[model samples]
Target chain A: MKAKVYVMLKEGVLDPQGAAVQHALGALGFDGVEGVRQGKVIELDLATGTTEATVREMCEKLLANTVIESYRIEM
Target chain B: MKAKVYVMLKEGVLDPQGAAVQHALGALGFDGVEGVRQGKVIELDLATGTTEATVREMCEKLLANTVIESYRIEM
Candidate 1:
């Protein structure tokens, strides 16, 4: 099984890296962009029959910082 | 419109961050992981009618380093 994890900052958290990207895009003259949020994707190649619950535990334990981020998993 | 851009290192690239995460997971007793790869996701909020071409341009010009990374865009 393969698992893909998306870890993104929470709604109220400020993302400086995302802000920098948005600002740079404006400087490049593609001004249609209004907002930007940057996140992480971790792809795991797991043994067959690895359950989604195990992947979720990985996210909670190490993949994501729950205080400032939220994560979703796809298997 | 919204664009979700995923930037990942090419297959041949060495991903030390991913290796570290995999090692950590093993230390934490979840040993089914065979491999791991880390990537970035950038979400863009654009004006309605923004074309996929525009997002591709962003990836080519700034969002991804095409020499070592490949990017996919979802709108």
Candidate 2:
């Protein structure tokens, strides 16, 4: 089975990288862009019967820093 | 308007970050994980009437490295 994890910074967290990208866009003449939030996706090809619980555990333990980031899992 | 850009390393491209993460998972005992690919998501809050063409241009120019990465846009 295939699974995907989307990890993003929590609302209100400062994202310097995103801000830098937004600034770069403005410099590049993409003035219509208002804001940008950057995140990551981790795609996994898993063995059969890998439970959602295990994936969630993976996110909690290693994939995401829950204090400042949140993650969603899809299979 | 809102737009999302997902940028991923093209198949056959080497991803050291993904490989490192996969190795870490194995070290932490996630034996069922077969493979992992890491990508990025850029969420954009755009001005009204921002065309998809402009967004694609942004991806082409700044968001993705078309030489080794491909991007998908969602609105």
Candidate 3:
């Protein structure tokens, strides 16, 4: 089965990369742009018997850094 | 208002970075993992009256490369 995970910076984290993008957007004529937070999406095709718990562990252990990010898993 | 955008590779695109991560996962003892696809999530804090249509256009024009990826918007 396919599992999709969304990983995002926790609230209050400063995203310099995203800020750079936002600045570029303004220079490129997108005046209405406000703020941007950048993150990652990881899609996994898992073994047939893999449990959600295992996937969640994967996110916690390797896929995301809980110190600065949070993750949600979808099957 | 806040808008969340998800940008992901097309179904058949090769994701080398994701493959690298999967390989590392296996080396780190996550044996049941299979395939991985990498993508991006961009969160936007918009002006109060921003329209979803404008956000969608931003995704198409700058946030994602339609040649290889697709995007979704959430309010």
Candidate 4:
């Protein structure tokens, strides 16, 4: 099975990278972009029987820094 | 309105970062991980009426490097 993890900054966290992208968009004449938040997606090809709990453990251990980011897993 | 863009390296492209992550996971005893691919997600809070075409244009122009990456947009 395949598991996809989306790791994003928590609400209220400042995202400089996202702000930079939004600024560039505005400069390029693509107005109306009011906010931007950048994150990461990690796709894991897991062996059969690898449960969702294991994926969550992976996220907690290595995939995300939970202090400022949150991760969601889709199997 | 909101737009979420997912950008990933095209298949057959070498992803060293992903390989490294896989290696780390294996080192940490995650044995069933067969493959890993890393990507980026950009979430945009758009002004009302900002069309999907505009989001695609942004991906084409700045959010994704079409030569090596492909993007999917959710509006």
Winner on lDDT between 2 and 3 is: 2
Residue lDDT tens for model 4, A1-75: 899999999999999999999999999999889999999999999999999999999999999999999999999
Model 4 Cα shift for residue A4 (angstroms) = 0.3
Q: lDDT per residue, candidate 1, A1-75, as tens digits?
A: 789999999998999999999999999999889999999999999999999999999999999999999999999
Candidate 4's displacement at residue B2, Å, is 0.6
Clashes of 1: 0
Docking outcome class, model 3: medium
- lDDT, candidate 1, B1-75, per-residue tens: 788999999999999999999999999999899999999999999999999999999999999999999999999
RMSD of 2: 0.5
Model 3: per-residue Cα lDDT over B24-46, one tens digit each? 88988888777999999998888
Residue B23, candidate 3: C-alpha displacement in angstroms: 0.9
Error of 4 at A57 (Å): 0.5
Off by over 4 Å in 3: none
Question: How many clashing pairs per prediction, in order?
Answer: 0, 0, 0, 0
Residue runs of model 4 more than 4 Å from their true location after superposition: none
Candidate 1's DockQ: 0.91
B1-75: candidate 4 lDDT, tens digit per residue: 989999999999999989999999999999999999999999999999988888999999999999999999999
Candidates sorted by lDDT, descending order? Answer: 4, 1, 2, 3
Provide the lDDT at B5 for model 4. Answer: 99
For chain B alone, what TM-score does every candidate structure achieve against the true structure? 0.95, 0.98, 0.96, 0.98
Q: What are the models' TM-scores? A: 0.97, 0.99, 0.90, 0.99
lDDT (C-alpha, whole model) for all candidates: 0.96, 0.95, 0.88, 0.96
- Cα misplacement distance, residue B12 of candidate 4 (Å): 0.5
Query: Residue B16 of model 2: what lDDT?
Result: 94
